[model samples]
Target chain A: MADTESLLTTPLDSLHRSLGARMVPFAGYAMPVQYPAGILAEHLHTRAQAGLFDVSHMGQAEILGDGAAAALERVTPADVQGLKPGRQRYGLLTTEAGGIFDDFMVANLGDRLFLVANASRKAEDFALIAAALPAGVTLQPLPDRALLALQGPGAAAALGGLAPALTALSFMGVAAAEIAGVPVLASRSGYTGEDGWEISCPAEQAETLAKTLLAQPGVAPAGLGARDSLRLEAGLCLYGSDIDETTSPVEAALIWTLGKRRRMAWDFPGAERVREELANGPQRLRVGLKPEGRQPARGHTPIHAPGGAQIGEITSGGFGPSLGGPMAMGYVAREHAADGTALELLVRGKPLPARVAPMPFIPHRYAR
Target chain B: MSELRFTKDHEWVRADGDAATIGITDHAQNALGDVVFVELPEVGREVTAGEAIAVVESVKAASDVYAPIAGTITEVNSALTEDPGLINREPTGEGWFFKIEPKDPAEIAALLDDAAYAAFVESLA
Candidate 1:
């Protein structure tokens, strides 16, 4: 067993402490969960403007060798070979039984494949990927780099003034550039479902770059509190909470993430199971749920059917700052997966009225 | 002031035989920080000593406040439904959580006093 304390650290630890951030252990690293501004204020701030998030704990790595793409393909159910240079794709990694290990983003850089996995699951993902790789392939973990996400509608314009090259970069595109003269790997991607950029830079220089970006207009420092709510508004899944090894991509409602090319031969681990689900659909499906009122239906809240029959349970939930209402994402019987089907969440043993709805509760603001 | 009582989970109570008003200490709320949602206990529900009575959610985490002593809930702070931040502002006053009818008053004496709670909170820091 690996000691989580030996996991990783970002350069901005002192800066986060200085800002009175409520530091919490996340993904093996001590990270800021929220600031003194609080999660609600930070959440609303990001929705109205831009929020600077220190996601440096996220794992960044590079796959080296001629079989880099093919090696990655053996573990993940994504067509990495077809990915053009500078383009990134959201994909799922699964176990031998078709259970998802993690969901991550992979980018082709013409030479090496850029891999970014969740911080908490990075070590496991690396081992899984390495175990499945062919001989002569090299997996270099770039834990030395830090990743930051500047999200919201104001993000694009803020980057436009600092990194003009980003102005031409469309959504899902990456560019090796510099922000305010600091070398950075900037990508137009985010989990907040907003127009933003994920910047990868040297771990030692992150604090300086973060401070520089924070100095920009309309950019406020956000914490993990807002990060969760913002991603909930966007209908994104939290790796450990919403999706885990026990849950399959289809059951988690992430079927679209599996590229058709990769699904054909089902070479990836758990391919047979994933293919079965794709063909006949999973017994239960994850769906978006909007409560009838301001009260939220959180994780572990049991989902009940028409006559109060237990159907499923909520996985992730929160009050969406942008949507102005309560939203949740959970899995229930496939029979109850319709957009207008009525459901209930058993909160504190009392059922709270809920309705199945489409995701992206507040809509996405990508620079498409 | 009424005789103050405490719980191991950090809830404070002022009992008058049957009716006991409960609230978290100022140190507890400060340690938790910026409470966003509070799942309050419902009236007329019977709760046992040391059992979870309410859930308080901060931005990043969720914690439960348990019953200090066995009792039946008589009233809950309805105001917390719309303004959960009151716990951050006045945890001992307007933020008072609930009132319970304790089945046993002797349990109240077993709790810590204000001075002891102060020491416990300091140890955590």
Candidate 2:
């Protein structure tokens, strides 16, 4: 409700157009789906070398107050109080009924907690935080800043050359520094499941930072098409697409993200239901499914058991360009979540043979 | 060789006696960007005018190629199995999807001629 449909623009819009990118409406922004290099090449490029992505449309903000962490604790179950400076954690916002509203990343900067959330859910997330926080804590949205992701094995080297301090930050770590003389708040985390960095800087300085990063030897401008495929390869969940109000973290196999302290205290939103589900496993869980053929199941494909009984539906499905096969991720009955369980995905009315497989069908190569 | 004609759906056919070689227009292929997969119609299949006969999937999206006229499939372009990108590279040559024996050659006459197809392409741009 907070002006979510307003079609935001990133600093690199002109650059994407100049590179002959096919722009499409995504998360209320005119983002490039693919470029002339095609998605396959871009997918492979991100896994091998560094790929620069304009993630400016994502929500980046700062939480301020003496009890900011305590106030945020009401909505999110994550133990923000225990977070030390420079460390970050993956957390989720939930409704009172225990449905996941959105999954986000939170990092403790020196005096404030920095949070980055999905673009489409930003307005709702901010409103929820504002409504939950006490008078002392103020929700500060960083309107003048944009975010960029540099992902791949070579990202560290490319970024380190620009700012030597970047190389010192470990995985899930944050640091404030200058890249090529432009100030930035960068974190050693990204969605690609590779060792990478997410750089946040003022909108006016974004163009210079992007140009400097793209000028690196191994860095190339990657579009959203490759980003989706790459994240799928990494076995990361995409909010709104992979999980929504109807899905719970436990059912999504994301219960591990809930802190042990938070679970025991049950102070977060929907804690009773979440705790009950944890005690007795959720009725369903998200699992990786690999089909036998080249034709992908894509989203909304019906998943069935041996007798053509509908058991679940595919949430995110596509051809894994890097894995060289068709892959999908969907929810199935908890009893059927085990790997190697044979299933069928009804594609275009004909059932295709598929088997439950452990995810990242391509194993993640994170730097740890 | 009777003549080459085009359907409004962007399919081109070169009528030879009662048979025709069916392929997409150069303009259609260019618009498709990069061809990644081609679903060809099987030989001996029957199709009605304007009915979808085959599918052409590019890197971005999938498109159905309609039958230019009522016809029976005679032969298919097997070359696409090894190299589907040929459609993007050469929409009128090795990229042809299949050949058909037309049930009514008069339907071909009603299709767009080269000049008309050229004008249609220009109008689209």
Candidate 3:
């Protein structure tokens, strides 16, 4: 962990503190990991109602150039060229060697492409994209902006008044709107497997926007701890932990993000291995593990076949508050990736029986 | 004559003659956030002072519950298996992990009392 003194602070820094949040050093920022309500309550609340999260530490940027989309397509596997204005698509910046450098969201904002990449990889992503740009393309990082996510079944009800138009946006829809008179780029999307909106606004007005949303019925301030459990139950990948430079998209079961046209063109970085693996199937694939016991098989725990031979390793694991049981995701040999295949996770040097289960342990409640 | 004592590791020992009831301190449970599971030592298992005797898992991470003083396990808290959140709700009461027959009840005097344990928890902050 980086020294807290040197960590960056978001516009909601004082608000989080005032709300009695437990501050932790995360991705070079002094961010709240959980509020006084606690992670379990926050996770359960979001599933049942609404939860607000301060995600300002993530890198926000805009790509400007007549051929910006085409240029971006060269670095990422997602179909940037086909991304229509006011719509967002999940993206992956893959390495030449077929491993994922980072996963991000690319939204077409009419004149430019709005990008939100992981904060831990923001600096590296900017440099990578900048260096790959063809002549005339420019990338601008929005250091002066802050991002917040209002998520859950009750999200629309809570945010309808603040940003009237936001409640109508479909999943993955993006629009520029005013909330409490503050201009914001609100998107109908979130990491949690629930209906929600991610609102990007100028840093100066973030606190007001957050407070306005929190004042709504059923809206409560949540932090990173609940965020992690929510995403895990959603079966979404967490960069660096669940997916990284050493893992390929095919292996991570994220081949769906690869554009159909791009698959034929095979022109993006790492396209060869990605294409081959997509056709032939990877030797190992990421799968969800339902551990038989309550003890969570956390990251780096060795996974094995019934006979005690190592098959793979757990990348992310924890207690699923919604499921009321311990669940995990990890890479297992293709043979063991089939749902219901019996596997064992070595926790505390003891092999605990686990079974490969279909992901999204809890069904996603995203609004279509 | 039962008395409460604490260890540097944040476990509490309620000594009554040669037997003691043990549980993690409120301070420890608070630091651990939501307790999801508790793995207790089996009854009749002998454990040395400061040894890792049980395990407590929270949403964030799993932690070892150490023996505050040398003792033999006499009874384990079966209630925690069904409801581990008891640790967070009542760390000093219903959340007690197990009972042990201490090898030396005299060692209770060596552990921190209420005032000293409060100061110890303050030092951490």
Candidate 4:
């Protein structure tokens, strides 16, 4: 942990404190980890209702000019040039070695491409994107904007009351809208695998916007604690934990993000490894793990085969509040990655029973 | 009659003669938030003061529950294995982790009493 004095504060810092949030240092910012309601209640609430998360620490930027999309394709594998206006697509910034540098969301906003990168990697991501961009295109960081995610089964309903036009936006749809007369850009997408929206507004209006959203019925404030559990249950890869510079898209089971045209062109960074992996599967693959007991197998727990041979390591593991049991995700040998393959998780010097299970420990209720 | 004492680590001991019942304090449980599992020390196991004898896990992370005084474990809380939430519901009562036969009953005198512990918790805030 860094010094508390050196940590940055989000636009909603005082709002979180006012709501009794337990703030902790995350990605250099003092962010809320949980509130008075605790992680369990917050996790369950997000599943049953709506959770408003202040994700301002994440990096927001815009790539402008006619060839912006094409320029972005130089470093990423997503079909950014084909993204329709008012639509967003998940993208992975690949290293020259075909490993994931960072995972981000790129939204096509007609004249420009808007990107949301993980906070921890935002600085490096923006620099890499800028350096890769062609002469005409330019990267513009949005330092004065704040991002908030409203996620859950009831997200649309809660947010719909404020901006009814948001309800008409399909999944991954982005649009300029107004909530309580505040100008904002909202997308019908979230990381929680729920029907929801991620709204970006001016930093000054963040507190007011968050308060307004929380005022909605069945909408409550959740912190990073709930956010993490929800994403894990949704089987989403966390940037630093699940996928990193050492992990390739294929090994992370994110081949779907690789566009067909990009694969054929082999123009993106690390295209050779990705191409080779596509032709012949990667040596190890990421898989979901379901422990047989209540004890969770936290991150870095060694994974072993039935015969005691170490197969891989757990990247993200914890008690899935929605699953009401322990759930985890890790990389394993291709042969042991099959669903229902029995495995052992070495926890506290003892081998705990676990198995490879299909991810999304619970069903995703996305409004596709 | 049992006399209650508290450790700076937030564990409480109810001393009845040479027998001592131990559990985490309500403040500790509140900070932990929603206990999901507990790993108790084995019965008859000898432990020294300040040694981590058990583990208590919440949804977010796991923490060690230290032994506040030297003693031999006499009994373990088996019920907690089935209902770990008991720690959140009754942290000092039915949520007791274990009982021990104290190696030195005089150690209880050095532990904080109710008022002193209350002040200690206040200072932390």
Off by over 4 Å in 4: none
Every prediction: chain A TM-score = 0.96, 0.97, 0.99, 0.99
Task: Considering the two chains of model 4, state its CAPRI-style docking category.
Answer: medium
Off by over 4 Å in 3: none
Q: Tell me how far candidate 3 lies from the true structure as C-alpha RMSD in angstroms.
A: 1.1
| Residues A1-368, model 2: lDDT tens digits | 23424666687888888888877778888787788777778878889999988999899889998988888898988888888999888999987888899999999996998999999999889988989988888889887898999999999889877898888988888999999889999989999888899999998888889999999989988888889888887888999889998888788888877888998888888887888898999988999999986666778999999766899999988777778777889999887889999999987677889999998788877666
C-alpha lDDT (0 to 100) for residue B14 of candidate 3: 93
Q: Give the TM-score of candidate 4.
A: 0.98
Residues A13-81 of candidate 1: C-alpha lDDT, one tens digit per residue: 999989989777777788888888878888888888899999988889989988899889888888898
For residues A212-314, could you state the per-residue lDDT of candidate 4 as single tens digits?
Answer: 9999999999999999999999999999999999999999999999999998899999999988987899999999999998998899999999857999999
lDDT of each: 0.86, 0.86, 0.93, 0.93
Q: How far is candidate 4 from the true structure (C-alpha RMSD, Å)?
A: 1.3
Model 2: DockQ vs. true structure: 0.38
Q: State candidate 1's TM-score.
A: 0.89
True contacts kept of 3: 0.62
Best by TM-score: 3
iRMS, all models: 2.6, 2.3, 0.7, 0.8
lDDT of 3 by residue, A102-146 (tens): 999999999999999999999999999999899899999999999
